[model samples]
Target: MAFDGIVVASLASELKHKLLNGRISKIAQPEADELLLTVKSTECQYRLSISADASLPLVYLTSKNKPSPMTAPNFCMLLRKHISGGRIVDIWQPGLERIIHFTIEHLDELGDLCRKDLIVEIMGKHSNIIFCNDQGKIIDSIKHVSAQMSSVREVLPGREYFIPDTMQKVDPLTVTSEEFAAHLTGKPMPLAKAIYTSFTGISPVTAEEICSLAGMDSSVPAQEYSADILLHLYTQFEIYLSAIKEDTFSPGIYFDGKEPKEFSALPLSHFVNYTRVEYDSVSEVLETYYSTRSLITRIRQKSVDLRHVVQTGLERNRKKYDLQLRQLKDTENREKFKVYGELINTYGYNLEEGAKTLECLNYYTNEMVSIPMDPLKTPQENSQRYFAKYNKQKRTFEALSVLCKETLDEITYLESIQTALDIALTEDDLAEIKEELTNSGYIRRKYTKKKVKIKNKPLHYISSDGYHMYVGKNNLQNEELTFHFAVGNDWWFHAKQAPGSHVIVKTHGDELPDRTFEEAARLAAYYSSMRGSDKVEIDYVEKKQVKKPNGGKPGFVVYYTNYSMVIDSDISNIEELE
Candidate 1:
């Protein structure tokens, strides 16, 4: 769900407090839809990120740096020339709408200080960054919208800056109980649909939350509610409105059967059985969701080729194995046929000359034996034919047995690599994985050079209880963390039946409590590619029991007598080290 207008207002307020009077030290366009502004206030330097991407428009503070275009775009150059040393005077939002305006004081041509407005609209498919002169005339914009783009209003150079008038929806902050009741009775919509449709800023998430607080069915017909039920619903809605007005909000994800059903400012109805986890602020929610999604996206893009390579190898090995298995089965059948024919040739003469079957007493052992042969063929001829087939099959079986074992081994190796690729966390880890695939011939090498040895880096996380947890992002890191960084008493975790990073909990030789185990499991689950799944089975064991299998793929290992738990792949609680 997108951030509510109230949340955006709160964010604008916070940013105003932090950024007002700050000098613009640097400006860069790190992406087509994003702008990074480095500001220096008297207290500290801050990096503020603003994005107008149609899918996810946001503004937040970040510590990360990104590469920019070598040659700046015309819009970027214009912004740099005019706003280089400007001071942020104020930050405001438009009537709880998805729009933020930053007024900056900058020196004009005559050295007179004047204010210019930088407007950012966060509305989906209509988001834009517009620069306006003191008179509110548009100078330029990241996107130039003409009459063709929007029939209601055109956003172009020299045009007067005006907010477009769209269809009006009820403002939740100003809605009265009578108005809400009238609207509900006028439409035969579901309770949640009524709330969402009638409100200007309320999301479906908030509507569902209101229904949950009222103990009413979100999917029930709005007009079907009794007077008492409607009154109760109105009271709860007022409480939610009051919370937003006071800026007292909680951020959490609501789950239905361990799957995230909604992320919202209030508790939701569909996930009433889910335990409510709390966060300190709405900013935390934004940061966690944005960063985690961004990280997963980056990792997936980086490992695409490596994953394809491993899959190809796996398929090839499987075909080879299947062929060899079929050959082995045929060989066994042929050998059995030969043994029967030899018995028949040795004893067939005691019966009629073209006999298909014979029963006779052995002279030496005084025992009976039965033999069968092809009725149209001589016994000697039948024996020769069977012997020839048996010899050929025996040789084929010997060859196939060796090849089958090799193919099976290759399949196991490729599968292990596939697992590692799935768990890769960072670009560096992906590079190492690709190198391994290339060395094994799963990936073709474009250039031959000496292997680059990079120092292993551990993934660091601080648990909810303040205990430190370290995870290995690659095989070398895994070895270092388990053997060098971890002590005997440290706890370890891995994903069951999945390729994943190794997670180690460093206790400093102190006994780990039960909460620590769950925290470690979350880390182990989150670090793997399966982090977004409803449940990830994690196996935890003492550090001493963990052993890397010989010739195993990177990050492959075996452990025994460990404890296991099915946990939600939620890292919302874990704090990653900077």
Candidate 2:
């Protein structure tokens, strides 16, 4: 995520190799704050996209082309007037700052060859694309920063073009150990923060990496480190800068679970615990990382309403289940009341009229029992009162037993929907989930009354033994996969006693291999609510053994016989059909 100076340096190196001495064939402004230059090199055409957006400033070489407006913006026309058909004589990065300078030579109106600098500054919020003359005087910029906007610097025509020294940061490429150590003499911030703020182009991620290489903690204060430790850290810092100076960049992205977390031009050692994906070019890393991150983010935002619906259903059902359990506990002593009534009726024949209490032998546990009678009533009347209490409690217990089971089933079904939401990747996947909620009455259908199109299909995979396996994304899909898609002998797998995906492996009447059994178990574990657990107990049985009871929920099934296995939830090696 840190589009820092080292990335700019790597980009400069790549651009120099691809665009240096190349001719600009076309220029277009597809966006107000963006420019695309089509450059023809030795045998290939590279589209260099430059964006100076206030939110996301970017510069990268892309193969994808964008359609431009029929009319070019004023800034684009100015750039074309100056550098159209220009040959890129040089491309360089200043020190380790987040800037790229493209020195272009083209014929002027006077038939004389002239050089102009197209400088792109990728500073966040202040990033701009400035066109300057050979004399370092700014002609114009994609964005204007006037005195009213900032007192630090003003970007305008006829003004000298210079990178603002607002931070007074030293160049990491040339800083000596003394300069590095002296700058952080009294800084109270963390060691990693002090390093990045004191030097240009070194991101906090890389700073933490330097500290890790030096066997120190980045969270520790800078002033807490000994002189030797500081010197060791400076040495590690030099190694990173040296690599950058040598144009040795290992661009990669680190993932937190299945989502991309951070990316950089250099290897991030501090993120060793995360999943790292490497690429050969900085542009590839940036493009892939941001696109995947954006797509996932977009899907999550789209699933918010559906998640809210599922979460609300889950919460309501859980509360009802808890209350039912409590009421059911109150009925646990109802059997004892029934025994009391029988004992009273048997011993009442020996009791005098209006007796206060009677002691009698209880046959249920071979122990003596005491029965208290209402003095105003006859002993038989007291026995009748006990019988009335017993019958009421017994009825309540019977009724609550069925009601509690339904509540718990609703809870499990809602939990399965929540798991489905987490596994959703595409909009179509979300649409299926939402449709299920609507049909189940948890969510109200929209007024448009559109036709229900079943676009989201169950996930299909090929096991190592060449067996076909399918996993349901939601409960409705689970029913369809198990009942409609699978045959009687197909193997059905699910996490034991947990809400999970219903996995079906088509056997085709052929004896299944041991590998296929394990693979199906793994899928069952991976798609369950216990997906994060190291090992999940899985229940596997033939589809014919699984029965859908009358009036059961969509995914609910009963099976008296099954085989079990414990498997890890790793599906990385499983081949999935898109």
Q: What tens-digit string does per-residue lDDT give for candidate 1 at 273-325?
A: 45455566556667766676678678888788787777877887898799889
Q: Model 2, 403-447: lDDT tens per residue?
A: 998898898888888988988878888988888888889988887
Q: After superposition, how far is residue 45 of candidate 1 from its true place, in Å?
A: 7.0
Alpha-carbon runs more than 4 Å astray in model 2: 166-168, 181-185, 222-226, 255-258, 269-275, 339-382, 445-452, 464-467, 488-490, 506-520, 542-544, 563-567
Residue pairs with backbone atoms closer than 3 Å in model 1 (clashes): none
**Candidate 1 runs further than 4 Å off:** 1-4, 19-50, 53-56, 61-91, 102-118, 131-140, 157-162, 165-168, 178-198, 204-235, 249-292, 321-375, 380-409, 444-451, 458-472, 475-578
Count clashes in each candidate, considering only residues at least 3 apart in sequence or on different chains. 0, 0
Q: What is candidate 2's local distance difference test score? A: 0.88
Worst 10 residues of 2 by lDDT: 266-275
lDDT of 2 at 549: 89
